[model samples]
Target chain A: MEIFGIPAQALYGQLALGLVNGAFYALLSLGLAIIFGLLNLINFAHGAQYMLGAYVAWMLLSYLGIGFWGALVVAPLVVAVLGMALERGLLRYLRDVDQIYGLLLTFGVALILEGLVAQSYGWSGMPYANPLPGSVDLGFMRMPMYRLVAIAISLVVCLAVWIAIERTKLGAYLRAASEDADMVQAFGVNIPRLIMLTYGFGVGLAGLAGVVAAPVYQVSPAMGSNLIIVVFAVVVIGGMGSIAGSVIAGFGLGLIEGLTKVFYPAASTTVIFFIMILILIFRPSGLFGSTR
Target chain B: MTADTAMLSVRDLHAWYGESHVLHGMTLHVGRGEVVTLLGRNGAGKSTTMRAIMGLMKKRSGSITYEERETITLPPHRIARMGIAYCPEHRGIFSRLDVQENLELPPVIGADPLTLDRVQAMFPRLVERRHSPGTKLSGGEQQMLAIARILRTGARFLLLDEPTEGLAPIIVKQLGEIIASLRTIGFTILLVEQNFRFASGFADRHYVVEHGRVVDEIAAGDLAAGSERIRAYLGV
Candidate 1:
C-alpha cells in the first residue's frame, strides 16, 4: 500500500510523529485560548510559563534527585501558584487599564523569565530522564514507549480540561465572565476571582505541556521561545478566544506540518502561515470561532 | 428599612469612571416586590446607579445596603449571589451562547435556580428560540432572553436598563406585558428608561435624574402635573 507518494510504513511513522507533535500543540493553544477568552489578554508570557515548567521539573530532578513522575505533579502546581501570584499582584493592577497594557506586561514577564533561565543555565540544553523509559514495538514499526505515553497523557489532560470548562457548572460562569464580565459579576459570581483562576489554569496547562515535552525536546530556556511563534500561528489559524478551535487547529496544523516534511520538506516551515493567510481570506473567525 | 422589605438600598452613593464622576451622592431605595424606575434623559447616571448597586464599577465610594446589610465593598459576583441581577443598556446577552445556554448561565451560581421551563414560561420567545444563538435572535427576543436570564438567577432585585430601547412598537407592548407579569410575581425592578411612556405604565413612582443627581421625584399617577419638571430636566 502507498499513501501520498510514500510507503505505508513511512506514512504511518509520520502520522505517529504528527500525532505526538499535535498533542503538545493542542495543549499549549488550549491554555492560550482560555486566557485570551476569559481575560481578554494575549499572554505573551505563556511560553515562558511553559519553560518554567520544564525548569522546575529539571530543578526537581537534578538538585533534589526527584524523578520525572514527581515533577509532573509538582512542577505544574508550582507554576500555577506562581501564575496566581502574578495575576493577583501584577495583572490585577492592570485590569482597569487598556487591554494592550496586559499584553505588554506579559511580554515583559516572558523576557525576564527567559533571561533568568539563560543566566542560570546558559544556552546549553539539559537532559531529563524519560519517566516511562522504554520502547513499544508496533506491527508496522517500532516506536518509543515514552512517545506514546506523552501522547496519551496530553490527550487525557486536554480532554479533562475541555470537559471541565465545557460541561461543569463552573464552566457556565466562566463562559459568562468571558462574554460579559460586568453582567456576570452583577449576577453574583466573583469576576476578579474568576479572572485569577482562569489565569492560573491557563498557566498550569502550559506547565503540564512543558513537563511532557521535556523528554521529547531539549529542556532549555530557548525551548518555549521556539514553540511560541508556531503556537501563535496556531492560535491565529484557530481564531482568537475559541476553545474548540484552538485544540482542532493545533492538531490539524501539526499533521499538516508533518505531511509537508515527508512530501516537501522545504515548505514545511511556512505551511502554517500559508494556512493562516487562507483562513484570514476565507473564514477569519476560524473554523469554530464565532464572529462575535 | 423594614425587615424583609428592602431588597437593595443605596445612600450617599458615589461612583466614578477614571476622573469623571457618574453618580454623585445619590440615595435610592428599592422595596421588595416594588417596580421602581429612574427616569432621565441620556447621561443622567442611571446606568451608573445600577452598576454601583451591583458593585460592577471598581473604585466605588459610598454606602450600598442589600437585605439591610452593607454591600458597598463586596465584589460583583457576591452581589449577584445575594439575588441581584443586572441587565445592561446593551442587553448583556452572551451572543455566542444559544438561548438555553444563556439561561443556563445564571442558575449555575444563583442562590435559587430557576428552571428552563420557568423562565421560558415567563418569556415564551426565549423558549421558542431556545436552540438559537443569542446574536441570531431579534432585538425583542434578545431582550426577553436577557430578562429571563436574570430571572433564572433567582434575583429578587432586577436592574434593567432600557429594556425597550430600539425595539419595535409591537415588542415594546410585549415587554410591558412581561414587566406586568414579573411585577405580579413579586419581583422588585429598578428600571432605567429615557422613554417616559414605556416606564410610566409599570413604575409606581419615578425619580427624575439630571446631570448625575436626582432633580425631582414624582409619582407615576401625577406625571401629567409634573410635565414642566420633566420638560425642564428631560427636555422632551
Candidate 2:
C-alpha cells in the first residue's frame, strides 16, 4: 500500500499522530482565541496553565490516588479557579492600561509558574500511565486507542463550543462583550465577573487539553512551551478570535506538517511556521477572520 | 425638588479621563417618568456624565442617587441591575447579533418585561429585519434597535445617547414619537442630544451642559423664554 509514493502504513501512522497533535492544538488555540477576543489580552501564561493541568493531574494520581478519569474533571476545575484568581487579583488592575502592559504581565506570570514547576520537578518529564494502554488495529494502521479517544473527544468538544458560541444567547453576550463590553455592562450584566469567568473558561480549555495529553506525552513542566509555540503559529494562520478558524487550521496545519514529513522530511518541523508566514503575507487577518 | 422626590440626582460629579479631567461638577436631577434632555456640543462631557452616572467611568468622584439610593460607588452592571439601562452614543448594537438577538440581549432587570410584540409595535422595521445582523440595519434602525432592546430589559430609567445623531429627518421624527410614547408608558428617560429641535418636541425639561457642568436648567414650558441662552450655549 502506497500514498503519494510513500508506504501507506508510515503515512497513516503519521496522519494519526497529526490528528492527535491537532486535537491538542485546536483546544489550546481555541482557548487562546476566546481569551483574546473578550479580554483583549494575549494570555502568554496559557502554556504554564496547560502544564499546570498536566502537573495537577499527575500529582492527583500520585498523591491522592485519583485515577485518569477523575483527574480529567478535577484538573480543569483547579486550573479554572487559579485562572479566576489571577484575573481578579492582577489582570483587573491592568484594564485601562496599554496592551503591552497586559502582555508583559501575563508573560511574567508564565515565567514564574514555569520556573516554580521546573524547580519542583527536574527539567526532564515524568510519565503517566496510559489508561487505555492497547492499540486498535484498523486494517491499514495500528492506532493507539488513547489517541483515537483523544481525537474523537476533542472533535466533539470543539464542535460543541463553536456551536454554542455562534448560536446561544450566552455566546452572543460573549461576542458582543468583546466588541462593546461597556454596553454589555450597562445592560446590568457584570462585566468584571463575565471577564473573570471567561478567562477561567478559556484557560480551562488548556487544562482539558493537558489532561488529554498526559497519557500520550510525559507529564512535563517544559511540555507546554514547545507545543504552545506551534499552537501560536496555528492561531496566526487561523485568525485571531475566530473559533472555527482555529479548529480547522489546527487539524489542517497538523496534516500538512505530517504530509511534509512524508514527502520532504527536512521541512516537517518548520512547515507550520512557513505556512504562517505565507498567511501573514497574503491573508493577514487569517483564513476565516473578519478584520473588525 | 428633594432628593427623595427625584428618580436620579447627581451632585458635584467629577470624572477624569487619564490626566485630563472631563466632568468637573455635573449635577442634575430627573423626576420619575419625565423625559429629560441633556443638550451639549462635542467635548461638553454629555457622554462622560452618562458614564459617570452609570458607574462605567472608573476614575470619578460623584454623588449619583438613583431612586433615592446613592449609585456613585456601584459598578455599571450593578447600576444596570438596579433598573437604569444605558444605550451608548454609538447605538451599541452588536454586529455579531441579529436584530431579534439584540432586542433580547439586555438582561431583564424589572418585573414587567416588554413582549416582543410590544417592541415590534413601536419599531415595526426591527421585526422585519429581526433575522438580519443588527449592524446590517440603517443608522436610524440601529438607534431604534438600541432603544428597543433596553425596553425588553424592563428598565425604569433609560439613558439614550444621541438616538437621532445621524438619522434621517423622518427617522428623527419617528424617534421623537417613540420617546413620547415611552414616556406615556411611564419610562423615565434621560436623553443626550445635540438636536434641540427634536428633543424640544417631547422633553419635559432640558439641562444645558457646558465644560462638564449643568449651567442652566429649563422646563419645557419655559423653553421659549430660555431659547436665546440655549442657542448661545449650544453654539447653534
Candidate 3:
C-alpha cells in the first residue's frame, strides 16, 4: 500500500529506524543541554566521550565476558568518573578565563581522544552483538526488541534526569547555581563541586547514549561525530532553557527525518539542517528557548 | 570576632588594582547591629573599598576579617558565606529570574534563612511583583528588591553601595525608613553614599575617604560643626 507516493512498509520501517535514532538524539542532546544549562560550556568533547563509552562497553564485553546489561550499567559510570577527573584537573583552572577558551580546550581534548581511538581501533567498524535476542510482534508490524528496549531505556533515563532537575531539592540548587552562581556559593553550596558534578552528569548521559548505540551502529571513532551535529540541531530546535523542550524536539525531529526518508529519500539527509535554518529565521531563541 | 559581637573588622587593609594603588592602609570596623557609612566625593574609591572588602576584584594586598576569620585570600563567594553581604553599585539581581526565584537563590546554604513573607513585609512592592521578572521592576523597586534579597540570606552585615542614588524623593524617604527599620531588626549596615544628606540621616558614624584612603572619621552629631572638615575633604 502506497501513501503520499511512498510505500507504507518503507514509511513504517523508516519511522522505526527514526525512533531508534531519536533515542540516541534525545540522550545526546539532553547531555548537551545539561552542560550548556549549568556550566555554559559547549563541551566539544562530548562526541569523544560518547565514543569512549562505546569502546569501554565493547572492551568490557570482549575481555571480561561482561553481559550487555552489565556493560550498560558500568560504561556511563566510568565515563562520568573520567569526566570528573577532567573537570577537576583541567577545566577548573580555566574558569577565570574567557568562556571561549573552555570550548577550545574541550575541542583539543576531543581531537586527542579521537586520534587515540582511531589509532587503537583503526578506522574500520567493530561489530557488537544485540543485547536482546529476538524481535517482538506488534499488531501492525514486527519490531526489534533491542531497538524498542533502547527507546524505552532512553526515555526512562531522560525522565529520571528531568525529574531530578525539575522536582528535587538538588535541582533547586542546580537551577540557582545556573542563574546566579555567586549567590548560590554565598549560600555555601560549594559552587565548584556542583559545577564538576554537573559536568560529569552531562558527560555520563552522552556515554549512556553511546552504550545504547553500540549494537545498531558500528562502534567506530566516527560514530558520535556525525550524530552530534544532528543532536545540536535538535538542541537548537528545542529551547536550551528547558529539558522538556530538548526531549520533545529531539524525538519530533527524528520522526520528521524518518518521514522524509520514506517520501523523498534524497532530501532525508538535508532535512535536519533545513529545519535548523528555518528555526533560526523564525524563532532565534528556539521553540522552547526564552528570548531573554 | 564572635558572630554575636563584631560583624566585620578590616585592619590596616592595603589593596591595589593592577598598577593603580587603592585602599592605602585603610582600617574600619562595624560592630554588631550598627549602621556605619563610608562617605566621599566622586573618584574617592568608596566603591573600590567595598569591592576590595567583598573580594570581588583582584587585590594587591588587604586583610578583610569577617566574624574574626581572616578573609584576605578567600573567594568572593566564600566571603559572602561568612555572613557579609554586598550590594554593589550596579545591582546583582538575576534579571531573567522572577522576583521570588531571585529571593529564593540566597538560602541554598542551609543557613538560618528568612522567609518570603518576612521579606515581603519589609518591601511590599516585591510581594506585589513576586511573579514578575526582576528586570521588569522599576529602579526604586529594583533597589528595594536588591536590599531585601540580601536581607533574606540572614546576613548579619550588609555593605550597600549607593542604595538611594538616583531615586525619587518619595522612594528615597521610603528607603530611609526601610534602612531604619532594618537596623532595628539587628542587621549591621556599611553604606557607601555620594548623597551626604542621605548618609547623615542613617549613619551613626562617618569615615570620609579620599583617593582610595580614609582621611578622617567623625561622629554623626558633630557633622554640622565640622563644615570646614567636610569642605576641605568631601567638598560638600
Best by TM-score: 2
Model 1 C-alpha lDDT per residue in residues A243-263, reported as the tens digit of each score: 888888888888898888788
State how far residue A145 of model 3 sits from its true place (Å): 2.3
Query: For residues B130-164, could you state the per-residue lDDT of candidate 3 as single tens digits?
Result: 98987789889889888888877777788899998
> DockQ rank, highest first?
2, 1, 3
Return the TM-score for candidate 2, rounded to 2 decimals: 0.97
Where's the lowest-lDDT run of ten residues in candidate 1 chain B?
B1-10
Residue A230 CA error for candidate 3 (Å)?
2.6
Q: Pick by DockQ: which candidate is best?
A: 2
lDDT of 1 by residue, B70-185 (tens): 99988887877777788888888877577788877775454566676887787777777888877799888888888888877667778899999999999999899889888998
Fnat of model 2, as a fraction: 0.96
Evaluate candidate 3 by giving its C-alpha RMSD to the native, one decimal: 3.4
Error of 2 at A54 (Å): 1.2
Q: Score each candidate by Cα lDDT.
A: 0.85, 0.90, 0.83
Report residue A235 deviation for candidate 1 (angstroms): 0.9
User: Model 3 segments beyond 4 Å from truth?
Assistant: A237-245, A280-284, A290-292, B1-6, B11-26, B41-43, B108-117, B124-129, B226-236
Q: Write one digit per residue (lDDT tens) for candidate 2, span B49-121.
A: 9888988888999799988788888888899988998888988889988999899988899989888789889
TM-score (chain B only), all candidates: 0.93, 0.97, 0.91
Highest-lDDT candidate: 2
Give candidates' CA RMSD values in order. Answer: 3.0, 1.5, 3.4
